[model samples]
Target: MKTLLTITLTSLLTFNIAFAQTPEERGLEIAIESDKRDTGFADQLAEMLMTLRNAAGKESIRKVRVKTLEVSGDGDKSISIFDQPRDVKGTALLSYTHSTKPDDQWLFLPALKRVKRIASRNKSGPFMGSEFSFEDITSFEVDKYTYKYLRDEEVEGKATFVIEQFPTYQASGYTRRIVWVDQEIYQPLKVEFFDRKNSLLKTLTFHDYQQYLDQYWRADRQEMVNHQSKKSTTLLFNNYQFKTGLTDRDFDQNSLKRAR
Candidate 1:
């Protein structure tokens, strides 16, 4: 009887501990697990076609090449170079993202023959007149936000975990972002951004995901809709290549300026 009582007591204690976890703790756990699943894949290269649509349905398109390098103990580094749309040709954006610190970003312009550093506070501004802000393009780091598990729901027939993440970056313009992460791939299917005023700012949806290397998933298209501006931007990604053997030199400011 004494041994049985001891075992029963220990089981009850463990159950209580599990049920007592706060929403914030659970949310962080989910984020950490999701980040863990996406930790591999040393590098990636892809092409993107960005189409911007105005309230009146006027549209414009730009072709771009993107490169990404995964970093250990920190966020990823990415570089984007404009290849088409003669006017924007030779333009390049480079970023080194971090978990707790503000991201370092620079824009190179062939016409000006200069490289301009992006201010941390200006991370909220639009990126080249697109619905995506400078912050939107930066790599998502788990430590960049404080999270709270909102609930579990289904998004487009896929089971998803919904969580609210409040940005920890000082210059962030968003009050919070609600994310719906798919249960299987841990990829975010939908995100709703709220501005500083806590008003709905934009909604981003990921579609047509394809798994690469039989392990990693890549979305073919991402659409960002601006609720207030009545405008939207669609980025169609193509030709995803992994393990491209890219190094730090490929993402330096020199590379950005030298991009053609």
Candidate 2:
């Protein structure tokens, strides 16, 4: 009877030990596991940003600036500008995407006679003379990449999910990318970029996140560095407003020329 009781006690202890997990450990697990399921936070995030509409009851403005550089490998050189609100009061610079195809671009430069069109076909050329190709800038949308969970680790004191995102678009210059996302905020902290040859090309870091409208989060600054060239670009976001009555007409090509 003593031997049987001892055996039963051992079995119960084993079961409890296997089932028990601390809250932090559980949170970590959930955080990591969530990355493995369909639609990673990266995709969700991009979709959220793209689909975001100006809220009806809010009035606000956003300001943005993009600075570009040309690396040693390419002879192509150019700078582009864009603005939003399609009016004079608000100056929300939208995007400065670079390409070889006449540097496909639209600018709202108040000084210019009209919104200029960029039509260059150097698709494979480096952007701003940096290691990053033009394809990188035009790829802010979420549907461009497919994701998979790699592992979990701590980054800057917070448990994080390290996920690998593969580009789905045919025109992309990258083969894959690894991103680190904070478990609590679901915000991407860092990204490792890989070229078409599957080699490390660059690194991107996001910082200074601030909450807006109690539910929305925005990164105040973002920096991207080329591993090979040692050159980088830093983007700053200022005066961001949500639900600010933006319309489809605002994104129109004809409106570009008239933008302030």
Candidate 3:
């Protein structure tokens, strides 16, 4: 019976090994899968209406046109140009997000007739007085953060995987972000941002997602609420056109000045 005992013990050891995945590994796997689902759309063009609400309930609106170009082996490049609101008209922001390095960003102020490079240390600041920070607008790259699987839950009747990710880059204002990723579309349904002190700072929720190119999903509306400041911003996207043949030259600093 010694051979039978050896075989049973070996089987038990194999079973244990098969089920030994840590939370970190599972979280990374989920992120990789999510990133994989929405790849290979050469470029995109869209328009957005940003509504900003202050603590006192005052409202301001900004109209913007967006262009994005996909890059292989790296993150995407995008530019946002303000079209309306006389004060901010002709202003633009260009971002070149990287997978493992600090993102390159530039802001062109029409009033000043110049382009200013955004410093990595200041990425956490709000973008044009909106609740969404500069870092928040950058393209999501899996390598930017370390992940931990939290739990499975349902968001708005859709099943989701909850995960916490800590930024691995420098000068990040957030300590951790909890993301609720929709199981069906493999996209983020909601995200909670925690400040450096580990306090809940803000929450961003996605709404009204529409599928494009038969495979890509895009959120038509996104709302961000700041808990401490009692401020909020809502972004409504429209006219999403894919494969617009955008090039790197369209995202450069020089392009920012000519965005108008």
Rate residue 233 of model 2 by lDDT: 62
Candidate 3, 1-260: lDDT as tens digits: 99999999999999887688789998999999988888888899999899999999999998988899998788799898888788788889888888667788888988889999877576688877899987787777788889999999999999999999999877788999999999999899999999999999999999999999999999999999999999999999999999977798988877888987
Better of 1 and 2 by TM-score: 1
Query: Which of the two, 2 or 3, has more lDDT?
Result: 3
Q: Which runs in model 1 stand beyond 4 Å of their true positions?
A: 1-10
State model 3's lDDT: 0.90
Tens-digit lDDT string for candidate 2 (1-260): 99999999999999887678544354445444443331211211111011111223222322323322222222212223333334533221223333222234554446545554444344446643443466654433344456666778898887887878776555566788888877777777888988888999888888888876565555777767767655566555665554444444454555555443
**In lDDT terms, how accurate is model 2?**
0.52
**Residue 26 CA error for candidate 3 (Å)?**
0.5
Candidate 1 per-residue C-alpha lDDT over 1-260 given as tens digits, one digit per residue, 9 for 90 to 100:
99999999999999998999899998999999888887789999999899999999999887889899999889899998988788888889888888777778898989888999977577788877899987887777888999999899998899999999999887888999999999999989999999999999999999999999988888999999999999999999999999979999998887887875
Error of 1 at 101 (Å): 2.0
Candidate 3 clashing pairs, residues 3+ apart or interchain:
none
How close to the true structure is residue 119 of candidate 2, measured as C-alpha lDDT?
Answer: 47
**Candidate 1 accuracy as lDDT:** 0.90
